[model samples]
Structure formats: structure tokens, C-alpha cells
Target: MDPHRLLIFREVARTESIAAAARRLGWTQPAVSQHLRRLERQAGLPLVVRHSRGIRLTEAGATLLRHADAIATRLHAAEDDMAALADLAAGTVRLAAFPSACATLVPTAMTNLARHRPGLEIRMTQCEPPAATTLVTSGEADLAVLFSHDSRLPDHGPDLQLIPLTDDPVRLVVPTGHPAATAAAPLTCLASTPWIAGCPSCATHLAHTCEAAGFSPDVQHSTDDYVVVQNLVARGLGVALLPQLALDAYHHPDVRALPLATTERALYLLCHREALQIPAVAETVRALQQAATAHRPQTPPAT
Candidate 1:
């Protein structure tokens, strides 16, 4: 089968729609359909079935897709190898990171790397942990910055390496002048309070933390944006638990942050183990580590 046809078929299989694949590839629908037809003919079987919803891959298509994924991975590795040959002086370092990290750490690191290696190019995309991991493992991104509360989050693959960046504490956010703002407020103290939670994972973590404190939070709002969560708290709609990095990035003056004694999220940097040999990747890792260290909040001296 033609490599080009195989890639086109793979895209179609991924999106489950010829039009969507064409849109992604910047081609017309007819072009994508034609390519799929050619690929199916070469394989000597029907690859997809059309329905009102979209398309579903046939058994043959599924079988071919498996090989296509492997080929794509190999091709991506080849591209990375060739780029590595260019050394640190030139080539792109693609990065995928969650919003909080992007807002806090990425800019400083990018600026530092740019000054150190003017010829190096950096590209970044904001993504959640799972998507960022996928981008790194699929070779779409050279590195990924992610966070998790669980200490034992699984690695993407055997060849992938994860570096712990920092443990960012979770802080309780309350409207300015609220009773909890000036005093030490434990998780149990906020049990009956209406709360604005972060994303699903963050909400789960918050719930677990509250449960461990012997109470369940009355979650009144749910959103992925930290700023929005803070605003909600500021408006006296609810309270929230926000990551330290996010608070550092954008602190709402209308709200106050109180440190939580029992909750924190672990930040991490992910990349292929072999990619470290490349000068650009090594330099980027260094820059990221420096940024992470600089951004980490210092603990107050014990009284």
C-alpha cells in the first residue's frame, strides 16, 4: 500500500469522518474520499461503512489502522532522529503543557532558552494531562508538562521518562473579608460551604481531601479555568481549592488564599528517554527545571 494513502486512511480512521479528516489535513472532502477509496482497493476490502452519524471502520480497516499507527510512530521517530542531527543550533522543540504551567513556567523557560540558543525554535500547545501525554508519546510534542495528585501515575511508555518538577500546594480561596480568609481554615471547616471546584480530576481530589477530613464539600460550581473559579469565589458564590502555580499566575485581589495542610499536586515533565541526547531537548529540560525551581513557593519560617 502507498505510504501516502495509508496516512490518509489513518487520518480518516481517526476522525471517523472523511470531511473531518479533510478539514484536519487542509484538503477537500472529495480528495479524502478518493484517497480512502484507493487505499481500500489496494487492501482488497471495504474499510469503512457510512451512516448518518459518521463512519465506522470495518474489520479490515481496523487491522490496517493498527499497522498505520505503528508506521506513523516509526516515521515520527525518524523525523526526530534527523532533527537531532542538526544539533542544538537549529530545530524546533515542540511542547505541550496544561494551562497553569503554560501561564507560569513556560514563558520564563522559553525566554531563557531563546537567549541561550538563538537558533532554536520553541512551539507550545496548551493541553490537559492526558492529551499532553498523548502529544508527547505520539511525537507531536517533544516534551510535556503535566500535573497529578497521585504519586504513582503511570508512565506513558517504557521509553518515556518523567521528571518530578515540584509539589504545588493547593490553597483555599475565599472572598475578601470572609471569616475564613484571615484565619487558618482546615478542609473540615469548609464542609458545609458552597464550593467552586476545578476540572473533574481536581474536583475528585478536592472531594477526596474533604472526605478524608470527615466531610463532603457542597460543590456549587465546576470549571477548568482557575481564573473563573477565583472569580466565582470573589463574587461570594462559592469557595475553591486552587493550585499554587495558578494562584501565582493570576491572583484575584477580591479573594484571599489560605494554604491547605493536606492537599497538593505534583508537577511533572515528560519526554522520550532517548530525546535527552539532543542538545535542544537537554537545554529545554534545564530551562524548565530552572523555571520550576524559581516559581516554587517558599515555606514560611516556623514560629
Candidate 2:
């Protein structure tokens, strides 16, 4: 199949109208329609059904659309590869990261990169780990800063590589006068206390840890924002488990952070294996490591 024709068909399939696809591609509608016709002839099947509303893909079109999307992703990666050969000062590096990492590590890395390579273009997207990983793997971003509560991360597939960035110790965050607002929280101290949780993955890890400590947390509220989590805790809504970076990013005066022995979020940089060949991406990675190292927290001893 012709790759160019596949791309045109993919665009039309996405927009559901040849004219809309043409507008986006800067081509005439008849030209796009002709390409689709030729593509269908090559496939030997009716690829689309047209009606007053728009277009609908036939079964064969749906199947081929998946391949077309993959081809498009590969083409984008090829573009990045060619761009990597250019001067480092003129290259671009894209990064995706979760909110906490964005708040702490990313800014530092970005600043350092800008200082060292003034002409380099750095782009960033704020997303959770799952979305961040997908962005890097799909060639949408060159590198991703993501976290896993699990020390052992799952296999993210063969196309990707991971580098451990730093360890962010988890802490017990409680209202000022809460019973466990001390240096070391045995966790059992808050067994019957109402709990506030963060993202789903963090909540799952919190639940498992609580169970291991001989009780299940009575989670009463949830929020993904670290600032919100600390603010809620300060208002005495419920206590929470938070990573050190959350406190480092923004801490509420009315809440206290106590040590949670053995619990920590493992931070990592994820990227396509080929991404590191680009000078801009490599420099970004090095800067990220330095930032992570500088901000690394000292895990409080278990009391």
C-alpha cells in the first residue's frame, strides 16, 4: 500500500469528511477523494461508506486504519531521528511528566537546559504516569518523567527504556493535632482514623500498606493534586500518605509530615531507546538527573 495514500485515508477516517481532511492537509477535497479511491483500489475493498452526515469506515478500513496510525507514528519517529542530526542548539526536546515531577524536578531541568543551550526548544506536557508513558512510546514526547510506587516496575515493552531518577520517601501527613503527627508514624496509630487519598495507584498502594500493617484505611476523600491533598489534611478532613516531593513542592503550615518507613515512590525517566541519540534529549536527561539528585530527600529513620 502507498504510505502517502494511507495517511490521507487516515486523516479522512479521523475527520469523517473529505473536505475537513482536505482543509487540514491543505489539499482540495477532490484530490483527497481521488487518493482514497486509489487506496481502495489497491486494497481491493470498499474502504468507506459516505452519507449526508459524513463517512463511516468499512470493516477493512477499520482494520487498515490501525496500521495507518502505527505507520504515522513511525514516520514521526523518523522525523525526530533526522532532526537529531542537526546542531544541538537548534534541536527540540519534548518531555511529559506527572504533576509532582512538573512542580519539582522539571522546572529545574528546564532552566538548566535553557541556560546551557539557549537556542534549544523544550516542550513539556503535564500528565499522569500512564499517559506520560504513552506519550513517549508513541513518539509524541522524547522523554517522560514518571513515578511508580512499586519498586519493581512492569515491563513497558521492548521499544522503551527506563532510568531510575530518584527515590521519594512517602510520609504521613496529618492535621496539626492529629495523634500520629510525630516524627515516626507506626501507621497502626491511624488505623481507625479517617483517611484522605491521592490518585488511584497511590490509593491502592496505601490500602495494601495499611492491610500489611493490620488494618484497612477508611478512605473518605480523594484528590490528585498534592496541594489539595495537603490543604484538605490541614482543614482536618482526613489524614493522607504523600510523597516527599509533594511536601517539597508546597506544604500547608497546618499539616505535619511524618515518616512512613519502607514506603517510597520510585521516580524514573522513560523514553524510546532511540531518543537518547539526540543531543537535546540526552542533555535534557542529564539535567533531569541532576535536578532529581539535588532535590533528593533524606528518608527519615524509623523510630
Candidate 3:
């Protein structure tokens, strides 16, 4: 397949509309359709089905789109490398991080970068770990700040390296003046108490922590927002297990926090091995490591 046509096909597949892709690429609708036709003819099969509203990819098209996306990723990485050669200070670092990390770690990292590498541009995206991983893998982001529960180890292929930043301890939050508030390391004390869970992974981590204390928690509410979780806990509706970073971002006055008995979530900076060769990306990584260390309580500095 023509490399250019493959990129066009990838864009069309992403937009799910030939006209939309045409608008984006500044080409006429018919011109984009003609290229799709040529690409399909070269493949010996129809890659997409025409529709009144938009196009739908056939199985063959879906298969080919994956290859096209891979090609696009490679092209983007090549562009980043060439840009790196032109000027380290002028290069851009695209960073994707989860919400809490954005709230706690990113600001400090960006501030340090601005002071030291004034000309380097840092673009930030808010995403959970999985989506952040996708951004780094596809070359949409130069690096990602992500976390994993103690029960889960991240393996994002050999091409990418996950640099350990800090161990974010999970804390149990209870309503102020609640019975569990005065209990020392009250994780077991709350096993029978109603609970508010955070994201799915956090909920799972909470469950495992409670299980280690010999009883399962009775979860009654769920929310992705740590603020919401804290408010729910403050209302005496349910207690919650939250990462230390979330509390660092915003702690509700009516909630009492205590460390979980045994669970510690790890924060990591994920990136392609080759990406570190670029000075801007490397500096951003260093700054992130420093930020994570500063934010973490009693954490040792990264090597």
C-alpha cells in the first residue's frame, strides 16, 4: 500500500467519515474517496462500506487500519527525533497523566522545567493509566505519568520503560468524629462499614487491602473524583480508600485520613526508550521524578 494513502486511510478510520478526513486534511471529499478507492483496489478487497451519514470499516479495513496506525506512530517518532536534532531547547514534550497526578505532580514539574529549560514546550493531557499508555505508545505523547496498584504490575512491552517515581500510599478516609476515626490504623475497623470506592482499579486495590485485614468491605458508593469521594465520606455516607496524591490535591476538612495497613500504589513515568535520547523529554522525566519525590511523604530521592 502507498504509505501516504495508508496515513489517509488511518485518518478516515479514526474520524469514521471520508468528508471529515477531507476537511481535516484540506482536501476535497471526492479526492479523499478516490484515494480510498485506490487503496482498497490495491488491497484486492473493499476496506470500508459507504453510508448515508458516514463510512464503516469492514473487517479487512479494520485489520489494515491497525497497520496504518502503526505506520503513523513510526512517522511521528521520526518527526520527534528530527526535531530533537534541530534544537533541544525548542523541542516539545507531550505528557499525559491521570487527574490526581495532574493536580499534584504536574504543576511542580512544569514550573521547574520552565525555570531550567525555558524554551522547551510541555503539553499536558489528562488521562487514566490505560489511555495514557496508549498516548505514549502511539507517539501522541512523548511520555506519560501513570500509576498501578500494588496488586498489578505494568508491562507496556519492551520498547517502553516504566521509571519508578514514588510509592503513593493509599489512605482510608472516614467522616470526622466517626467511630473509626479514633481507631488506630482502622482498616479492619471499617470492614463492616459502608464504603465509597474510587475508580475501578482503586476499588480493586481497596478490596485487596481490606481482605488482608481479614474482612471484605461493604462498598456503597462509587465515583471517579476524589473530591466527590471525600464529600461522600464527609457526609457519613461511606468511608473511602484514596491515594495520598488525591489528598494532597484537595482534602475535605470534615474527613479524617489514615494510611492503609499494607497497600501502596506506585507512580511511574512511562516512555519509549528512544524518547530519552531527546534532551527535552529527558529533562521533563527528571523534573517529574523530582516532583514525585517532593509530593511523596518521607520518600527517598530517585537515582
Each prediction's RMSD to truth = 17.4, 15.1, 16.3
Winner on TM-score (2 vs 3): 2
- The stretch of ten residues in a row with the least summed lDDT in candidate 2 is 177-186
Local lDDT at 111 for model 1: 93
lDDT tens digits by residue: candidate 1, 79-141: 886775466766788999999999989999999878977778889999899899999899899
lDDT of 3 by residue, 1-303 (tens): 799999999889999999999999999999999999999999999999989999999999999999998999999989986775456556788999999999989999999888877778889999899898998899899999988997466659789998888888877788878776667657767767898887778888878878888998898888989999989888889988888888889989899877555568888899999999878888899999899878878742110
Q: Rate the local accuracy (lDDT) of all candidates.
A: 0.86, 0.86, 0.86
| Model 3: lDDT of residue 120 | 82
TM-score of each: 0.69, 0.70, 0.69
Clashing pairs in 1: none
Question: How many steric overlaps are in each model, in order?
Answer: 0, 0, 0
**lDDT-based ranking, best first?**
2, 3, 1
| lDDT, candidate 2, 210-230, per-residue tens | 998899999998889988888
Query: Which residue pairs overlap in candidate 3's backbone?
Result: none
Give stretches of model 3 more than 4 Å off.
1-87, 299-303
